[model samples]
Target: ARQLQKILKLDPKTEVFLKRVSLLLTQIAAGDFGGARRRESFEDRPPKVLLKDRPELTK
Candidate 1:
């Protein structure tokens, strides 16, 4: 955060906003942050393939 503040020359308001976000992340484990989120991965993932209708490319 400090590095960003220095590099971006952030205004006071922006600095405060970043600090709030950092604090929120630190508190996520304690339920202080809003909805919790985390990454998940499947070990036996299926390989990607081209679909018949190009659904993968569109959506």
Candidate 2:
């Protein structure tokens, strides 16, 4: 989470930053950041990095 804040130039302690990160992780775990139907339009979908930090959610 700290690394994500740094990469996005966000303040790690801020609530907004934390919320956005949480949502991103939720999207990743659900296996569709923009839903399965919309994902088909994406030419390059990156793998979820959150999986490394919270592997259990993938189940």
Candidate 3:
């Protein structure tokens, strides 16, 4: 979670991205990504855009 916190510090909007990445990491760490099923779908938006639209994230 430290890495995710660091990424959040770099760009707070990364919360969503970081969450998804973290989830993926956890799944991979637990050896669950090798199946023929999808875990979850990440938003189709960019972090910068999310930050721009939701400045509250920088807080």
Candidate 4:
């Protein structure tokens, strides 16, 4: 594949990807696929995190 690309001069896909992303963002801005937005309040954070202190996970 690398040799084929070197011979044929393939272009990178960034422009195509960015175009699709911009369209998706436009849809999102117009609420085409919007779900319930979560609160950004600090109180929404969990009171305790359980996974960080697992004794068996210490290396």
Give the best candidate by TM-score: 3
The sequence of per-residue lDDT tens digits that candidate 3 reaches over residues 7-42 is: 557665667778899999998999888554542333
TM-score for all models, in order of appearance:
0.38, 0.35, 0.39, 0.36
Off by over 4 Å in 3: 1-12, 39-59
- The alpha-carbon RMSD values of the candidates against the true structure, listed in the order shown, are 9.6, 13.4, 13.5, 9.8
For residues 1-59, could you state the per-residue lDDT of candidate 2 as single tens digits?
99886778855567686898998999889887788566675535435776667778576
Better of 1 and 3 by TM-score: 3
- Candidate 4 residue 22 Cα shift, in angstroms, is 0.4
Residue runs of model 2 more than 4 Å from their true location after superposition: 1-13, 34-59
Winner on lDDT (1 vs 3): 3
- Alpha-carbon runs more than 4 Å astray in model 4: 1-12, 34-59
* Decreasing lDDT order of the candidates: 2, 3, 1, 4
**What lDDT score is found at residue 40 in candidate 2?**
70
- Superposed by TM-score, candidate 1 places the C-alpha of residue 24 at a distance from the truth, in angstroms, of 0.4
Error in Å for residue 21 of model 4? 0.7
Residue 47, candidate 1: alpha-carbon lDDT: 31
User: What TM-score does prediction 2 earn?
Assistant: 0.35
Cα lDDT tens digits, model 1, 1-59, are 99986879978899899998888778886775544332223223323444444566535
For model 3 the TM-score comes to 0.39
